[model samples]
Target: MIDFDYLKREIKKEKVTSFLVYQKGNSIFEYYKNNKQLEKLHKINSCTKSVLSILVGIALEKKYLTSIHLPVYSFFTELFKEQMDSRKLDITIYHLLTMTDGLDFPEFGEWNSFAPMVYHPNIMKFVLERPILHPVGTHMNYNSGCSHILSAILQKVTNMKTEEFANKYLFKPLGIHEFYWYEDKMKINKGADGLVLKATDMIKIGQLILQQGVYANKRIVSEDWIKTSTAPYFKTYDSIGFYGMHWWVNKLDEKNDFNYENTYYFALGFGGQYIVILPKEEMVIVITSEIYENSLLPLKIIQKNILI
Candidate 1:
């Protein structure tokens, strides 16, 4: 049996604001440093990208987006009309979804790497203008700009802001209210980060994915999309595991294959925010924290204390 009291002590030492473990539709363990945090909308950071991935699947199912293979230029015709690079036209929705767009905008490996694109006068233009360093769709680089462009694409095709589209379809169905999604100067929702949500609401999202896009007996997105989006498309960083559309697949046991049923996958954020789903164990884990640097610390704590 897992030691809840020991886990709470470990989490508290690590400065985690919230921690919860849900097994078979029940919260077996929960911890919050402050009771007020239960009501607060904490910033989830890059976990927003995973949420945007779900929105993309929903849009496809709704027929707002026909296919992931469609070239991004098809959505933003005006943006690419004057573009010089022929390769940019080849970048598709699938590339953006998988973070294999080959864009040069780097989010990691440098201090404040994401700031340059976020602070640009026109975020979409900044992303589009970046030269393609790697062959499109072949390499997987962690780029926030790709996700932002996705948000822009969503806005273009759906004729609604990303926040509005999510509210009407995703959030409402999951009963996720009292949330905030920040937008750039262009007023496009930040798909890469800047989403704030309650920790409990995070659990609902994990549960939704756990049920294969179903929530409360309602089909929010198709099961096929969930399986497709969460599959290990590319081998990611050694420490980070695999990358699916925007979700992450991690093999806790080295011997195990990266299958949906065997391994755990998660939506991770920069500052220790996480929604970890272990399908084989029939469990979901939610953790939100304030540690900005050394973000992986919380995961280590979880593995040592809970996942063991």
Candidate 2:
């Protein structure tokens, strides 16, 4: 069992802002820095990516799309007919999900201000024009642009915007109230990121995945889809780290670590928002923080308290 008292003490000691944990759909622990319930409508940053991944899975299950192996350009051929090179045509949805698109773009650059001068003119055109540095499926490069491209594909294939499709099929059914998705100038939700939801809603998302895409007896997503999304596909910047779809997979040794084989996967966001799903322990951990510099602190605390 997790030591709630010590966990709370450490959170307070380490200046954690808000933390909550749910095991098998039950609230097991909670703490707030200022003794406040984090608004259920706060921006959750890139946790939105995981949500988008779920949507893609749903799209696949519905047969609206074929498979991740299909080349991305195959779906958006008309948009890039003139500029689509053989290298670009080689890119696939699986590459996008695994962040192996090989397209050139800063994964963490200052795009907010630079959007006016560069991206606003023609985002897709600019993205396709970038140099491919590696063969698809051979490298793991974090690219927000790749995710946005997937989102655009989702819109084109589904004949509905990502936000609308998710709202109707995923969010509404899961009771994810009060959320917003930022859009590009072309009015496409930056499905690669740019979603804001409450901390509890984040937990709900984790829970939904933990339950294998089931919600309150309703099959919102398929078990097969969940398995594929959570399965490790590529390693990120860190050596031990790997990514599965849009989710980050943390590998821990069971013999050396208490929660070994537990396989704690999570949806991570910038500025310290996380929805962690510990399947073996039947636990879901939700954390929100303003300490962008110390975002890993919350994960470290949870690892120490529950998985050590």
Which candidate has the highest lDDT of all? 1
Per-residue lDDT tens digits of candidate 1, residues 1-308?
A: 78898888788787799998999989999899899987889899999999999999999999999999999998888889878988999999999999898877657666353447877878888888889889999999888888998999999999999999999999999999889999999899999996899999999999999999999999999999999999888885778888999999878778877665567789999889999988988899999998887788888887887676
Candidate models: Cα lDDT each: 0.89, 0.78
Residue 191's lDDT in candidate 1 = 92
Candidate that would win on TM-score = 1
How far is 143's C-alpha from truth in model 1 (Å)? 0.5
Q: lDDT tens string, model 2, 5-33?
A: 98888877764567889988999887776
- Which stretches of candidate 2 lie above 4 Å from their native place? 13-15, 34-36, 82-85, 108-119, 254-260
In candidate 1, the residue pairs with backbone N, CA or C atoms under 3 Å apart (3 or more residues apart, or in different chains) clash, namely none
Query: In candidate 2, where is summed lDDT lowest over 10 consecutive residues?
Result: 109-118
- Model 2's alpha-carbon lDDT is 0.78
RMSD of each: 1.3, 3.1
Q: How close to the true structure is residue 232 of candidate 1, measured as C-alpha lDDT? A: 87
TM-score of each: 0.97, 0.89
